[model samples]
Target chain A: MDSAGVLLDAQGLGRFVPGTQQWLLRDVSLAVRGGDRLAIVGPTGSGKTLLLRSLALLDPIDEGRVLWLSQTISARLVPAFRSQATYLHQRPALIEGTVEDNLRLPFTFRIHAHQDFDRRRVASMLEMVGRGADFLARSWHDLSGGEAQIVALVRALQLNPTVLLLDEPTASLDASTTQTIERLISHWHERTNGKRALIWVTHDRQQSTRVAQRVVQMNAGKLLEGT
Target chain B: MTVDGYIELKAWQVAIAASLVLLNAAISLGLQLGLGRSLVVASMRMVVQLLLIGYVLRWVFQSDSVLTVLALAVIMTIIAGVAAVRRTERRYPGVYWASSVSVLVSSWLVTSFGIAAVLQKADTWYEPQYAIPILGMILGNTLNGISLGLNRLEDELVVHRNLVEMSLTLGATSWEAARGPVRQAVRTGMIPMINSMMVTGIVSLPGMMTGQLLSGVSPLQAVKYQIVIMFLIASGTALGTVGVVLLSFRRLFNRNHQFQSGLLTAAGHK
Candidate 1:
């Protein structure tokens, strides 16, 4: 792939047990371009989560660099980088307050200070997933697992991030809710009109094929392409 | 050596007061509380420690040298710093240094201000009578605040690891991600001092005021000294709690706005 279309590029990323020689992720390199859909499938304990976290700069890596827009990201620009490239955890984490509060949290950060929370925008997104405007007023604690994941998805999508690193975002949800999440993510990618990328890690091979255009397999801390 | 109209207790009289621990031990044994041995041991340790400190203070006072007073103050501050982090259930690397620096800076600054600016009657800035007690009181209270703050911070970070990381992943600055835990920790640390302040002069008599009253100082004079001590302690505890909490925040998060949860290990974990 040429560098022109690549939005996120990882070169030989590795993570190891601190103060030990045990490697958790080794020599993994991947390129994500705008409008690209990639799925990473792996068994439990195969370091897929670690790989995704490393790409997002959520976890420290023992080796290699991640470049954004063809330039290595600097420490000062990490927040800016994160704002454009967001990570979604398998389990949703919402702050104490209403669902709207959790959705509005990102705007409270200095990095997003220039942005304002758009309730109408969020309400419309909720409507896409069969949720009403009242869903936005629901308390965070009242949200079911699937509902929380929807909130997490809407929150990230509303930010208009260029890249989304999803770590099995619908792992525990039911079939229909999982489909809804997948559809929501697909819509998010398509809405950007080939301007956004997705790196999804999932256990379901069918879901991988359904949501992603390219499939990669991770086994024993190594990335195998064209699985 | 006793001042006129001020009664001095004899050695036997103090021994009689010391015997009160035996009564406590007897009650513990009768109740099968399993605290009899600990009660006796603690009382014995307190007696020895207090007696040794009494002799040390007397010697330093007689020497009347600035170095002696300052050296004792530094030693006390170091001990207080160590004691502050000793009981925490969780700790990160450099926690000792963080706690110690917080304790040393807050207590020393407040004590110096008290001696040099507030209580200006001392012949020298390092007057043992004024400086030692002031430092001790401030250090004691500030130690509690630092430890409480540190413990609460660790607990919040650990329990809410996902929440904190979620915020960071959403592009929060280190301060923004940690603002909630920091606020809670600082409040936890300051609560005791605030409670004491709320109850002062109403619910219970404070130690320094009681000491002054027993030493034949006028009630109004004792009250004034107690007020100064209370204010100094309040500032010291606030500063120390905030300092330690902020320092731990820096240690727990990096310049990249990542929450380094790995750095924080629970107590007794390798």
Candidate 2:
């Protein structure tokens, strides 16, 4: 990826177990450029989720810094930065509401106060995943695992975020649903016209190879390039 | 001696009241409940503590000094604040300070208002007869509210860590992300007061009103005092619960909208 196209960059980022010398993520540096598809694969305790969280600036970093478009992020810009770089959890958490309420949640936030929730935009996005607009009215408890993940994806994608940090989003889903998610993500990336990027953390090597153009490995709180 | 139509209890009469605790211990022994020792120890502690407080209150009332009354009130508040955080299952490093400040500010504010405004018949705002009892009642109720609020806040945050973080990653400010837990905590804190208010008169006579009646106060005057005390307790509890919850929110989350779940350790865990 070209340096000028870099959207999210981490420089020697490190996170330790609060007061102990034990490192949870150490000396991890990564550069995510526009339209880049990167996957981080590691063992269960290898800190892949921590690395992704660090990149998203969701966790406190004991050392190093994360930059947005080559500029170091300040506290004031964190909300805006998060709006543009959304993090997706492995187990989707929907509020106690219908899917439409979940989709409208982001607009309720102060950071997104100026934005309006466009029903037509969300409906068309749902259509891409082969779901009808009627699906939005489904209660959160009624959604199947695959369907909940779809709502989560549509919720994040509707915000038009520049970078998506996904942490094993399909780790528990079946193969068919996983492919659908992969297709939906690729379609979203394609629609961004090379101005969007995604960092997918997964355990399945075949899935990584299928979705990511470049794959990195994590082990013992350290990042290794090229898998 | 009988004074003002109120019967005074003799030392032997008070001992008769103390002896009832032995019956509780006897029942514990009979049932093999393993609470005999605890029951005896708890009753003894209560007797000793109340006696000591009785003496201290007597001395303060005799002294008639504003400093002594205010000092005692402060001591009661600090103890109440510490006791409030003691029952929480999850706590952070600053939980005690947060609880204490919440209890102190809310109880004092409401008590001061009661003394300076509602009970203006008192010779002084810091009159020991008026201030100490009012502050103590407010502190007791405010302590309960702060404890419940702080406990519920930590519980919700810990249990719903994922949901809270999900909101944060969606670009929510800390206040926005924590709205659910905050609301729940405040509600939980206020519930006890609300329930008591609902049943205050019809269900049972409250302790203060009952005490006033036994002390030979007229029924109507006692009812008025009870009403004021109830309102004071309610406001104190509400203010304290909200103050502690808001303070905890500031401690648990930072300006960057990050939920520092790591800061919360299970109570008694290293």
Candidate with best DockQ = 1
True contacts kept of 1: 0.78
With candidate 2 superimposed using the best TM-score fit, by how many Å does residue A30's alpha carbon deviate from the native? 1.4
For model 1 chain A, the run of ten residues with the poorest summed lDDT:
A119-128
Fnat per candidate: 0.78, 0.71
lDDT of 2 by residue, B1-270 (tens): 888878998999999988888888888889999998788788889989999999999999999998999899889999998999998898798988999999999999999899888977445887788899999999999999999989999999988988899888988888889999999999999999999999998999999999999999999999999999999999999999999999999999987778888889988886
- Per-candidate DockQ values are 0.83, 0.79
Query: On residues B1-270, what C-alpha lDDT tens digit does candidate 1 reach at each position?
Result: 477646787889889998888888888889899997788789889989999999999999998998999899889999999899987998789999999999999999998889878988545877678888889999999999999999999999999999888988888877888999999999999999999999999999999999999898999999999999999999999999999999999988888778889998878886
- Cα lDDT tens digits for candidate 2, A1-227: 45697899999999888889999888988999998999999899899999888887888889999999999888888988998999999999999999999999999898888989999999988887789989999999999998999999999998999999999999999989998899989998888689999999999999899999999999999998866
TM-score computed on alpha carbons, candidate 1:
0.98
Global local distance difference test of model 1 = 0.92
